[model samples]
Target: MSEQNQDKHQQRQQKVKQKVDERIAAAQKEQGIFQVITGNGKGKSTSGFGTVARAVGHGMKAAVCQFIKGTWECGERNLLEKAGVEFVIMNTGFTWETQNKESDTVAAQVTWQEAKRMLKDESINLVMLDEITYMITYGYIDLDDVLEAVSSRPAMQSVIITGRGAHRKLTDLADTVSEVRNVKHAFDAGIKAQKGFDY
Candidate 1:
């Protein structure tokens, strides 16, 4: 690169750094955040679990409440459980596969009980509610109940709710909301879900 081009690049980077430093200096709030990962794409739960793992890596207590994922093995769960993260799985399989509304509702309610307990416990630094939006959409769990529990959680407790089609109120209440858009997926190409990649 020419010297003039290099000087221009350095000036641009200095301005960018100044803006970033100013923003960092202006922000003073310190509290756990409520994050929602929702969309019609893959990796929503994967992203949530990544945050749980990050918290665990920091020696923070974490818990997971899996709503729609039944008794299937989960790679993230297998690893996080060994790291001392608590898990409360519904173990009812997917709703379409179960095909039993009454039983599914009972299981969802029972699982929610554990979730509520974890949410109330101040010791747990992070809580991941995996695929829970489906329960609210299916009316197996009440949205207001979930909202109440989340809103009333300890001030320093972070929460991650992951699933497709998140409710508006949940998004509104979240400090951070990320929607993953699906441009394409291998599953649509008749490619089966690969182990350690899809799961």
Candidate 2:
């Protein structure tokens, strides 16, 4: 590249950096953020677990309440649990797989009690509700209860809600919201879900 072109590129990048710096300087809040991860694409729960791992790395206590996974051994479960995260897997499987609403509701309610306890615990800095959207959609857990629990939790305790189809109310209440879009997946192309990559 010509020296003139390189100089122009550097100047452009500097201007962009200045704008970003200004925005960072303008923001002044320090409270814990409420984040919602949802959509048809994968990685919602994966991102939640990533946040849990981040919190643990920062010496912060985290609690994990998995809502719709079965008895399968997940990589995050093993890693987080071994790292001393307060982990709990609530559901036996997806709703269709279970074919038992009554038992599912009972299990969800019991598990939510534990989650609520963790929410109220100020010492726990992060609470990950993995695949919790299904609980609300399936009527196993009330949306109002979830809102109240997170709202009344410690000022510095973050709550991460992960799953598809996050309700508008939940997103509106969140400080940050991200929807992962599904463009393509190997499963749709007659390929099976592989270990580590899919789960």
Which candidate leads the pack in TM-score? 1
Cα distance off (Å), candidate 2, residue 7: 2.4
lDDT of 1 by residue, 1-199 (tens): 9999999999999999999999999988988799999999899999999999999999999999999875788999999999999999999988999899999999999999999999999999999999999999999999999999999999999999999999999999999999999999999999999989988
TM-score of 2: 0.95
lDDT of each: 0.95, 0.89
- Candidate 1 residue 63 C-alpha distance from true site, Å: 0.5
Clashing residue pairs in candidate 2 (N, C-alpha, C atoms within 3 angstroms): none
Q: Which regions of candidate 2 deviate over 4 angstroms?
A: none
- Summarize candidate 2's per-residue lDDT along 1-199 as a digit string, tens digits: 9999999999999999999999999998888889999999978888888889999999999999988884766888878788999877784877788899999999899889999999999999999988888899889999999999989989999999999999889999999999999998888999987878767
Clashing residue pairs in candidate 1, if any?
Answer: 70-93
Q: Compute each candidate's TM-score over C-alphas.
A: 0.98, 0.95
State the lDDT at 23 in candidate 1: 100
